[model samples]
Target chain A: MPLDAMTDVSDEALLVLFANGDQMAARALTLRFTPKVMAHAYRLLGNHAEAEDVTQESMLRLWKIAPDWRQGEAKISTWLYRVVANLCTDRLRRKPGLALDAVPEPEDNAPGVTERIQDHTREVALQKALNQLPERQRQAVVLRHIEGLTNPEIAAIMEISTEAVESLTARGKRTLAAKLAGQRNELGYSDD
Target chain B: MNWGIAMTERKFDPVDLDHLFARVREHPAQPSADLMKRVLTDAYDAQAAVTPVTAPQLPGAPWLLQVFRELGGWPSMAGLTTAALVGVWLGISPPDGLVATADSFFGTDDDAYLIDVAPEATFEIAEGFLQ
Candidate 1:
């Protein structure tokens, strides 16, 4: 399949094509999925370099499994989510007690614009709070709240029941709320 | 009376948690294009590493296994070799001829002995033992 033509095909079909040694299909799958996986990794890991690594690793796993890729068993994006999540969790475990606050700021080009200033503050606080969450809770919260995955989709990704996903997300939200409660006002969100 | 009772009632409603998380939904951080490019490049490279090299054969089947099957199954070849060895052994030494040689060395009678004994068990016997 041509890369351009793959746009019309479903991810599952593209993967099957990829398994058949279609380079265009491989490229298309990469282009289609890399950004989403990178964003998920960045939110989870809080570093661009690490996120890139995780994205690559996750997509490589997808390629490796393409031969046995069972259609309709699970969505490709959902599987990527789980792979990236596991990679992030592995990175976290390997470096226990490292704080997200310790992340070095990217070099600023100039004096902050209003939007930049607001974004920087929120990003810092959010990353810090996310760092404080337990691994599973962090994964659940990121998938559900940040990545906008539904409970059932997250359940499929995490290999858990929907009820378990609900419970995990609820707990994750509560934990995030408690962690960020003090900074809510600082973040400029007035609690009603 | 119902209206008066309803007017005094106060109800507690569950908080709208979605409203609290509303900010996060809109605050998605966009990674730089360069970062995305690097990541995608790495993914492409990794995918290349994982994607099986195409042999001039069917996809999804291991090339080595296919090769093995194409060149005769191992067990069948072993069975053929074993059958050939047994045939050679049987041809070299026929089973029925071996049994006949054993019967001639001792005498065909029910209580026959290989040695011929005189009435008083005197002289030696070595003549034509096969008879």
Candidate 2:
């Protein structure tokens, strides 16, 4: 089938097509999920280079499992999220050091310079605060607040109960608030 | 109690985190094109490994042989078994001894019935017998 026609196909159907050796399915799947997987990994690991590696490995695993992939049993995105999260966690476990250079580089455009700098500063501060959190809390916070996933989805990704997810997010948000409270003025928020 | 409840409600709206959420949400880190290329290559390789290739059917004799091969080879076990049974039946139920009968009728040697007869009469007798 033509690539244009494949746009509306579901991921489950695409995987079945891929298993049947359709190149278009592979292209569609890669285009559909690589960015999400990369972003999810990047949030968990905080390093573009490492996150990219994780994305590649995760995609490779996805490709290998396409032949045996069960349609409708689990959503492809959810499964990719779980793979990325576990891979990031494993890397974090092996070496407790997160590279300082993992902070995103600032853009060099001369326009809107101050706003961009401010945004970058806020991002760095948020990342720093997130890094200080326990791994599980960080995962929950990033998935829920940053990725905008629902509590149940976060729970499913973390393999924890929904109540546990709620607890972690509550605790995580409180800690994040306390940590960034002193920077409120610097971050340009109006005084309470 | 009213004052305490009001304080709790106010505390819920403390810090403005819209900026933080917006920045992270807006600028999710992206994988480079090179990374995507690598992934696609891997996908192609994986797909190639999975799908089976079927050979085209050969023409004429080869095609016929292939058909037989798929049917578990020609002259099957059942056919061979039937042929063997026919052979065994023929051996067990032998026909009467045709060679002995022929010798008695024509006289094999010395005391041959046609020995005393003239050649022409013998020929006549043999011709009559045949008729």
Candidate 3:
């Protein structure tokens, strides 16, 4: 199938196609998911290199599980999110006390120099604050705030109740606010 | 005016977390082409493992077994099993036409062509020719 034609197909169906030896399905899946997985892993791990590793490994696992993938039982993104989260957790556990300051500034040139600097600082501050959050809370916050998933989706990925998801994200935001509160001026956020 | 003090005092209003962290989405880390190639190769490998391969042809297999294998090994076995069951059922209750059909198709009576050649008749013919 053409790439555009496969765009409308569900991830589960694409996986089934992939298992059945359709190379186009594999291409479509990789094109659709690698970036999201990488971003999720990056936010959770706070290191680009580790995030890339997690993304590749998570995707490899996804490929391996494609044959036995049960459609309609679970969404592909949900499964990948769980895998990336667990993988990131393992990496974090192995090397605890990861330094957030080492995160390289993202490359962007569309915005003005001043705006880019402010955005980079805000992002760095957010990453630092997110690192301060407890594991589950951090996962919830990133999935909810940064990844822009719904509370129910976050609950599914985190394997927790919707209420629990809400509470975690709420607490996470509060903690981030508190952590970055002192740097408001430095982050370019002026007082009202 | 300090936000951290407000949060400590339980008086801090919830900030717009979505808008605050939106920059992260704008500049996500991307997988390099090398990583994409590696992933696709792995996918192809897994796909190969999942797909069923054709069984290699066994040289000098019996025709019957070959027929069965062609129909898919299991289906061929099933067909043979059904045939055996029907044969057993016929043995238990022979049909009227079955006897006639068997006699016409299998009986050797009045079929001289199927009988063995007489050795005496061949000898007599050879002796007459020699004389």
Candidate 4:
């Protein structure tokens, strides 16, 4: 199948293609999921290299599970979120390190307005504050805030109740508020 | 009650985090080409692992032989040939041997010959009707 031919195909359907050994499905899925997976892993691990490794490993698991993946039971992205979160949790447990030292670089160096530069600054500060949070808190906050997932979705990914998700995110936001209190003025936020 | 801290917490609605979240969400971390290549390679490897391999067709074999090969191969063909040989043997063998086998199946030798679908009177009735 042509690579673009799968553009309209659902992720679950694409996995079916992957199960059938269709290389096009592999390419299409990789192209589709890699960026989000990479960004997500980066947000969790905060190390580009480790995130890359996690992204690759997560995708490897996905490919391997294609044969037995039960369609309609779960969304591919949701399953991926669970896998990525679990993998990140394992790595963090294995070696405890703050993401402060490894703030991500801008994805590109495109010349743009000064606003983007400020946005980058704010992003770095946010990541630093997020890194200071407990892992569960950070995962919840990132999923709820950065990834824009709903509480219910985060609950599914984190394997927790929605109430738990709400608590984690609320506490996470409070801690982030404390950490980001000073940077607010510099990050272009004004009471006015 | 620490109403002071509670009051402080209530007042501190989180600062506008939308900007920060937007920056990260908008620019997804780019995956390196090497990583992409490795991922696709793994996908292909897993695909190869799961896909069943079919036996290659034997070269220069007749279709009939191939059909037989598919139908349980040599053992089944041997059994079928043995059965056909037995049938041919029974068909061409002398009537005496067939009668003996029939007698064994029925009862005594006379009983094998005596067993009939209908009496001779039935054949006469059919002949008279035709006339």
TM-score of chain B of each: 0.27, 0.34, 0.47, 0.37
- Residue A69, model 1: Cα distance from true site in angstroms: 1.7
lDDT of 2 by residue, A1-192 (tens): 554357889889999999999988889999889999998888888778888999999999999999998877778888888898889889888878967344645677768888888888888888888878888888888888988999998888788899999999989888888888878778766745
Report the lDDT of model 1 for residue A29.
80
lDDT for each residue of candidate 4 in B14-109, tens digit (9 for 90 to 100): 467665677778876789999989988998899999997766777787687679768887799899999999888887875667767776786895
True-structure lDDT of candidate 4: 0.84
Off by over 4 Å in 4: A98-113, B1-11, B56-131
| After superposition, candidate 1 runs with Cα above 4 Å error | A1-5, A99-112, A190-192, B1-131
Candidates in descending lDDT order: 4, 3, 2, 1
lDDT of 1 at A157: 90
Q: For residue A84, what is the lDDT in candidate 1?
A: 89
Question: Considering DockQ, where higher is better, how would the candidates rank from best to worst?
Answer: 4, 2, 3, 1
Give the whole-model CA lDDT for all candidates, comma-separated.
Answer: 0.72, 0.82, 0.83, 0.84
**Tens digit per residue, CA lDDT, model 3, A15-107:** 989989998998999889998998888889888788888998999999988888887887999999999989998989999976564655645
Strongest candidate by lDDT: 4
- Model 2 chain A lowest lDDT segment of ten: A98-107
Tens-digit lDDT track for model 2 on B84-126?
Answer: 9988886787568854676689767766755665666667777
Candidate 4 lDDT, A16-36, residue by residue in tens: 998998988989999899888
Clashing pairs in 1: none
Collision pairs in model 4: none
Best by DockQ: 4
Give one digit per residue, the lDDT tens place, for model 1 in A13-97: 9888877767677678877887788778877887767777787678778877888888898899988988888899898889775
